[model samples]
Target: MKKLLIASALLAASSIQQAHAWGQTGHRITGAIAEQYLSEEAKAAIAALLPNESLAEASTYADEMRSNPEEFWQKEAGPYHYVTVPKGETYKEHKHAPEQGDAYTALKKFSKIVKDDTAPLSERQRALRFIVHIIGDLHQPLHAGDGTDKGGNDFKLEFFWEKSNLHRVWDSGLLDRRQLSYTEWTEWLSEKITPEQAAKWNTTDPLIYITESATIRDTIYPEGDRLGWDYLYQHLPTAKVRLQEGGVRIAAHLNELFAK
Candidate 1:
């Protein structure tokens, strides 16, 4: 029993350490799709800022730095990955403190940094990478949590006969099960986005992203603790839609930022 308890504690710690929106592949997919929509000027500006790194390569930078020993990574930036708007409440009703910024606030903060010509190159690069990442993070429904279950991380379940949590299943399990590389997923989804859909989805408004995800979040909790094919069949379309929207919106934001 002692050994079992030790394993459980280790698992919990690992889960907390690893918590992030949309596993690496999902973030990369959004980044790749966003690249297809960038205006020439936007592309040039991004290339200048990121040099050799494509947006897809930069999209996971923030998450990849979570293990950094800096205070910003270890403590200050933790809440920026998600927001909490309890069921039936809007973000305005539960705005997070500025000192403890959430995704909405962080996006705005990073956007300014990315757009500032006087900002140090290193700072702007970091901000731009984070902007690419946090936009992807905000699209994951669980990231706009309903102020319960720690954005579904606390809601344990079995996914494909393996132990998992709601957040993890949504983060990677559903997308990973399809076994497609991020490029393939980006290609498949980008080809399907209609001009009308792109126009509609291309909004820099973070609130809309958060609200839409929160609304979706309320509907995604399964009726049981076990999830499999049926759940995927029902929710996969929604996940794809979110990824498409995230990519389109990321492009829109970057375009506007660099339009100067």
Candidate 2:
């Protein structure tokens, strides 16, 4: 038991390395919003896969795995969180996927597992958790990456006088500053999603999410390494849309998966 506790600590410590999608709060918001759109069939299937878990709770599992002692969790999962797209090009235009793996590739891999009825229960459950998280990560602009700066992780700045990076700013800094709980964000975004909007947002293609993120990412850099109200005013809407889209699309993905 002591050894297990020590390993858990190590995993928790490693989670601080990458800001990750919209951070935990953001992912939960996305997950909660997704709950609104899930079909009865999809809901029942998900319950079987994760008897005790909600989609929102499962949505951060991939990020949390960063702390695990397994090499696959520690090393292999890195590329699955983001994909590098060079400046001035789209993901399809660049045709890039890390040799090891990437979000798009990982999505394809895990998604297949989620859909395969023949797969072991344990494997499908793990894949379902990854699918939930990766869909959320896919919507975070930085997760699409612009090969120039480690997805803005390399771009240093002062966000409201606090030393931070462009990636961190987008991940959670702006949302955190608002001081809203994930449930509040979910409630607000959920009301705004009209059926027309949800239909348009629901798609299985990760490239659409990646391309949109990469395009938006290009325009989000702060001019003077100092970001304040002006930055928030201009970009917060985009961030909210991405979060909303993540939730709606995740619901669509699951609906299609279990619709079989």
- Return the top candidate by lDDT: 1
Task: Output the TM-score of candidate 2.
Answer: 0.91
Q: Which ten residues in a row have the lowest lDDT in candidate 1?
A: 10-19
TM-score of each: 0.94, 0.91
Per-candidate local distance difference test: 0.91, 0.88
What lDDT does candidate 2 reach at residue 227?
91
In candidate 2, position 50 carries an lDDT of 96
Evaluate residue 80 in candidate 1 and report its C-alpha lDDT on the 0 to 100 scale. Answer: 81
lDDT per residue (tens digit) for residues 1-260 in model 2: 99999999867656445558789999999999999999999999999999989888999888877767788876677788888788888787896676878888998899899888899998899899999898899899988887777788889999999999999999999899899999999988899999899988989888898888888888898789989999998999999999999999999888988885
In terms of lDDT, the poorest run of 10 residues in model 2 is 10-19
Off by over 4 Å in 2: 1-17
Candidate 1 per-residue lDDT, tens place, 1-260, comes to: 99999999867765675788889999999999999999999999999999999989999999899878888887687788888888888999976544778888889999999888999999999999999999999999999887668889999999999999999999999999999999999999999999999998989999999999999999999999999999999999999999999999999999999996
